[model samples]
Target: MKITLIIPTYNAGSLWPNVLDAIKQQTIYPDKLIVIDSGSKDETVPLASDLKNISIFNIDSKDFNHGGTRNLAVAKTLDADVIIFLTQDAILADSDAIKNLVYYFSEPLIAAVCGRQLPHKDANP
Candidate 1:
């Protein structure tokens, strides 16, 4: 089973390093890591390039929306069996998150499943 994890970023900077590290720690690492950046002025490109497992798609446009960038990333992975959409700031809690997601799909009736998201201490309710 091929899983494509798409991360939408814009000036994410060091935040992306943690996210990618978490992905690497996952029990089921993604087949591909696609980053859809909206022309970040920061060192996002260089940072992503340094990572061995990441494949970045820098989306250049005058006006960049999160939804639009996400759509473009999804469009690029047309052949993937499963697409996992994640924000640049989000870090996976457990290594089995990806494995769990794919396991649920073993049931033909289950087309989709969303895991619980715990808010960070700094995050507001």
Candidate 2:
């Protein structure tokens, strides 16, 4: 099974490295990693470019927004069997997170599946 992991980022330099590290630690690595960047002023672009398994999409328009950027990234991987949309600040709690997500899709009737997110120590509702 193959999955396309799409991460929408904007000035996420402080958090992206953690996200990338979590991705690398996944027990089942995604077939493709797509990073949709919205004109980051930090080293996000350069850092993403330096990653071996990641593909970066730099959206330079001043009007770039998360919704639009995510739509564009999804459009680029329409052929993928599963699209995993992740935020730049999100980290996989367990190594099998991706495997569990893909496992849920084995059911023929399942069109989509979402998992519960544990509250981050630094996140506020």
Candidate 3:
């Protein structure tokens, strides 16, 4: 399946690199990576923008919307069998994480899937 990943970010800070690295290590790397940034003052934009497989886009922070911006990113993809959405803070737990996400589409009847999440060690109880 042709899968594309969309990540939306602001001031992603230090966690973003770990997120990117984890993505690169996935057993099934996305065919394309699209990052939508709302004008971050931090290094988040440049960090992802320079990556070989990532395409970064800018929008005014004031114009950010939950569904709207993501829809915009989806519209940019040439074509994809499946589109996976991830936030900058979502670090994949293992290489199989993405592989698993894409696996569902193998079923001819399954058109989409959402991944399960486990709380990070730093989460407050």
Q: How many residue pairs clash in all the candidates, one count each? A: 0, 0, 0
User: Which candidate number would show the highest TM-score if scored against the true structure?
Assistant: 3
TM-score for predicted model 1 compared with the true structure: 0.87
- By TM-score, the candidates rank as 3, 2, 1
lDDT of 2 at 75: 89
Report lDDT (Cα) of residue 93, candidate 2.
Answer: 84
Q: Which stretches of candidate 3 lie over 4 Å from their true place?
A: none
Candidate 1: what lDDT? 0.80
Candidate 2, superposed: residue stretches over 4 Å from native: none
> Is 2 or 3 the stronger prediction by lDDT?
3
lDDT of 2 by residue, 7-108 (tens): 887888576777777888898888888988877898777777755567888777685787888889988887789989988778788889999999988989
Q: Per-residue CA lDDT of candidate 1, range 10-92, in tens?
A: 89856668777788889888888798877889877777776655788876756578777788888888888888988777878
TM-score of each: 0.87, 0.88, 0.92
Clashes of 2: 0
The alpha-carbon deviation from the true structure for residue 33 of candidate 2, after best TM-score superposition, in angstroms, is: 0.7
In model 1, what lDDT does residue 25 have?
83
Writing each residue's lDDT as its tens digit, candidate 3 over 11-123 gives 99878898888888898888899999998999898888656578888999999998999999999896988899998888998998989988888899997799876767774
